[model samples]
Target: MKKNIYLDFAYFIILASTFGAVLVLGAVVAPVVFHTDVITVNLLIDPYNAGIIMGEIFHRFSYWIYFVAIYVIAYEAMAYKMGQRDAIGFASAFVVVCTSLLFSAIYVPKILSMQALGVEATQSDTFENIHIASEIDFKILALALIVLFIRRLLILRVPSK
Candidate 1:
């Protein structure tokens, strides 16, 4: 069977890029945004304001997550139809789709709504729990993307004669 190099390459690129984005947002972006001390030497940004800023960032990112979820579903479904199926790859793709949708659809929207309520709402135990759960889900999404990327790479690599 002949493999379409372009499509396969695009898939890998998208998977890798998604993983990198998740890592950067969680590791690099979140800490810097939340830690006003890092960049707010002159201005005083309160916790609530910082939370609002972070919420905006995540809200914008939700669009990208939605796209990635749909793309992953289409790509994986096509691959499956082509008989290129495996347990690990299927599981990883499934994780990616579910986590992506969960983060964009459930977590981000809930967080935004809570933020909209007021500082008091954000400070509540419910907000804290949801925030923590979202963080964990983001981490899981990152892991799944990397796993799927690596597995797809291996599966699609051309054999040497």
Candidate 2:
């Protein structure tokens, strides 16, 4: 029972941190960086610079996301072994994590490389397609994190003594 309690606590901490990071990145940082007037108008208008800036932001946050993914998977696996039967939530979250990993490691790098090439590279259709894909992936990850957080919250209740 004590072990279960500790595991639950760990799970909550991991989930909460992951959800918080995703929320901040998606809701706060991305919007402020891309939409707000914080960055110079030239940077905002330049596709190459904009892509590099966004990629850098996500690259930094990706480290935290990777750590969260590992912790969440480990905790969920342990819970499954202990007969918690909540693997589905973990699986969904895993998919989200994997998508995020792909975006950060693979897609973002590609965008950065394209940005490095020149402005013409940024204006290409390939870059546009990848950019769209990245946005879609980000939205999917945000929604998945929200759903997982709500699911975990719903499962938690006070014990009847």
- Residue pairs that clash (backbone atoms under 3 angstroms), model 2: none
The TM-score measured for candidate 1 stands at: 0.95
Taking the tens digit of each residue's C-alpha lDDT, what string does model 2 give over 54-93?
Answer: 7788778778777776776777677567555555577666
Q: Over 4 Å off in model 2, which ranges?
A: 4-7, 35-45, 158-161
Cα lDDT for residue 62, candidate 1: 92
Q: Summing lDDT over every window of 10 consecutive residues in candidate 1, give the lowest-scoring window.
A: 152-161
Candidate 1, superposed: residue stretches over 4 Å from native: 158-161
TM-score for every candidate vs. truth? 0.95, 0.78
lDDT of 1: 0.91
Candidate 2 differs from the real structure by a C-alpha RMSD in angstroms, to one decimal, of 3.2
